[model samples]
Target: MAYTAPLLNKPAEGWKHDLPGPNQPPTRTPNTRLLPNPPNYVDDIYLELPRSTLAIRSVGIWAAVIFFLTSTVAPVLLIDFTVTEGHLPPFVLNFFGLVLLSTFLWIGVYLWRMDTEAPRDEPIRFNRLRRKVYVYRFFHDGAKPFSRTAWGVRPVAYDWDDLHAEACSLYGPMGTGGFIETVTLAVLKPGTHEVIDRFLFTHEIHRGEMYWAMAQLFMQQGPHALPTFPYVPRDWNNEDVSFNLARRLAPKVVWPAEMDLESRTAP
Candidate 1:
């Protein structure tokens, strides 16, 4: 079955414990280490963090790989078929070409859509005043590359108390060396283990605890309690050269009017 975002699975069973509240220390050491991507806004009201990982250079690399495979591998396969069969049927060659083209096209479209058309940053807003967390999720058809479903940012809000951090691991095909780790912030039903909604908190498993701690400190003790920010925050709205040139071609960050208002101010 195809996996979708906002996963609604029960909490993984284990010796589960409640996460520490504001003013309490996080399990992992906390530091203000926002590099590469920094918060657009961090104040007493809210901490807005950017979440897009792909850059424009990655797109170019993928395009090069696709070109190399099509130019070298396809011709080699054609020659092999001709030599082995003595005479290649037109329909056979056409069918093979069609299949190859379709496969490549699907992959190319998926990559392009993610790089250019998707939101520049899907930010998560932690409004401490309201004790609510707002997530700007990038929605897509996870299983189908050729799916025509609209791909865009979907904003949602939940009570801060309902969120729990879960560490998840995805192993590579046949249990190979390619391992992916992530921390999901799951929203559970009050007093129950059922997870109603989830948000990706961090891609780096090693630093996930630290990030959670930072959020806790900011929400509980305010910006005064946090450590000195290691690097200068990027001005995403204006001239920030840290981003790749292709990022300029992507859509700008714009939260919905109602959600934007609610997330920035206390009721």
Candidate 2:
């Protein structure tokens, strides 16, 4: 039996999930590049921390710039202070430069590697019919149009039962009187309070709907379910956390009763 999208009787066109809207596709295809074709089998598509190709490519550029500046300046500085001053042997300066270059080279590689798009990871995906958990980096494209163009690595199965989830978000003036926002859902270990995974959602304004939809998806019947968001994780970093909080709220989309009522009542 094909499991329909719960609480909604319609199939979503591509991965454009317009919650609470009428059951119909958008007038036209999205201009953003998607997978050439999504398969008939995927449903309830939720995207976390979607980034652009330009953003992904920028990592390498920044990495190169940092490495270039460091390589150019560090060697000269080491040579000037040590070899020029005759305080250390010539080999000492050479070895110091080599060590400095090697350290920054490793750091640059690690930062660039943090991009999931480079590795084609999904962060999280579900196959309701298969009753198996699909990992961020492990599934096939299913021929569907993707939210973003992939790096071409297929997604595979994740060996986990469920992801216990929590989200932490923040919004503040971008120094131009406009606000900037970011949110991330943490998938924690089922017990013992350990964060095992994280799926990021950048610049999304509707947090409540996103959280409700995810909780519903996880609570939906099947052998697997993602964890539910219990409370609105606090952002202590914001000294004026109350600023614009009420005016910038997202509409409730799902079972609000199941959420952390205590936090829901706060400013």
Candidate 3:
């Protein structure tokens, strides 16, 4: 299916149309025979997985662009402007220069905050025993990502039944000719189809089923329902040097005390 925009606020649909076989558990979301996205941490009670793949190189690229614009481009523009319009008031020229420099700086900072300032890995936790899902999210206004308001680690708990998964895809920016895909779990507003909230299940389109099935199997049938071999437990703390460094630089995953208790504990 060809999609031009990010899919949102619709009923979860478009999984493989086949019926489940004998081994698969009865689930609202589709199941896959293939292995699920492995958890960063798992136990009898809960399963935890990372939000997205981190690209450290992207950070460096942005940093370089910011440096070049502020140091080189700003000076060149200011010098040219002053020479060309010598009759203009010094303060007016200075103001223009400041605004131009500030715009570039803000763009750099905004991108940095949007990506790097977040927790090293915003993981989603499936508490099977509690029949609830805990999302460690960095909430910001959908329309205003650059705004300071409506932002932070506002983690939430949702009943397993209220959640639905959908596979969404969109074309990348014009020059890039790239494609972007994500499996998203949208939280419904009780009896209505209206979407209350949503988050990414996995960024990979091909493996979206596995990720969805992983959560579905765990929630519907418990930890025993999942595979044991390639889906072995992993320690997020003991990851590679790059991960360790990023973890150190990023904010710690600190859930609110009341929510922490409620999410992990059974009713």
Candidate 4:
């Protein structure tokens, strides 16, 4: 099933001030008063870490089997019994070296598999002031073997001005028991952060048509030169039907010019 759009109840705030066009007048609106008994805000959608114990065990078993076979069989087949004086056979030496290399390869594969299975915690918090979302699961807290393993973690932030859209396909099977295909215009924005403490700018692409609609401000008035990411749709017609219908029925979201500017300039 396609994802549902979230209702934004917060009052629109001033987002941008300096209009790009001279004739365009500044748009302003009254801020929505806070609810007397507002419900607590919580983030429920997030990428989940794979947690398959069977997968982990399977990898472990494979690694052990490979190590045992190589250690026992390679030595027996490669070692020469009747050595001339004290010299070892060249073929035997090469065979042992190959076995050692195979062992190292198996070990590397085991490590990689473990890393891929690392746990991911959910409901990551987003800080508007810092313009970044905090990822809680990618870091370890202790010095143990598993704790020493590092997972890839990065902040999610975007530049409102550098956003754009382009058509692409989304790969996956639809709910109707058929392959889905689509030509959606992905919404993208530029992001900045430190990878290993080095400054870098990366393009952040928002998948699904709903995100594009939610971020309409950028789609309508932001930068026009951004690129779209490729996708493969599972069900093109269904996606289009759902997305377009939602867009038509969704409530209009308005933002104040100054607040728009702040969101655009947020780091």
In terms of TM-score, which candidate is strongest?
1
> Candidate 3 lDDT, tens digit per residue, 80-191?
8767878544787677777777666666655555555566567888888777888888765534546776667777788877776666566766466976666767787776
Can you write out model 1's per-residue Cα lDDT over 184-266, one digit (the tens) per residue?
A: 68788876658777667766565665667778877877877666666776655565535564566667778899999999987
Best of the candidates, lDDT: 1
**Residue 2 of candidate 4: its Cα lDDT?**
22
Residue by residue across 1-267, what tens digits does model 2's lDDT show?
122332222221122232321112212222212222121122243222222222233445366458656766766787677756888547866787788887776555443333322432133334333333433332112232232343243334432333322223344434556443333333434543355554443234244234334434432532234332333322222324233232123111121232222112212
* TM-score, structure 4 vs. true: 0.29
Once superposed on the true structure, which residue ranges of model 4 sit more than 4 Å away at CA? 1-68, 80-87, 95-109, 112-117, 120-124, 127-130, 137-267
Model 1 TM-score, all chains together? 0.75
| Candidate closer to the true structure by TM-score (higher is better), 1 or 4 | 1
lDDT of 3: 0.62
Candidate 3 residue-wise lDDT at 158 = 87
Model 1, CA-based lDDT? 0.67
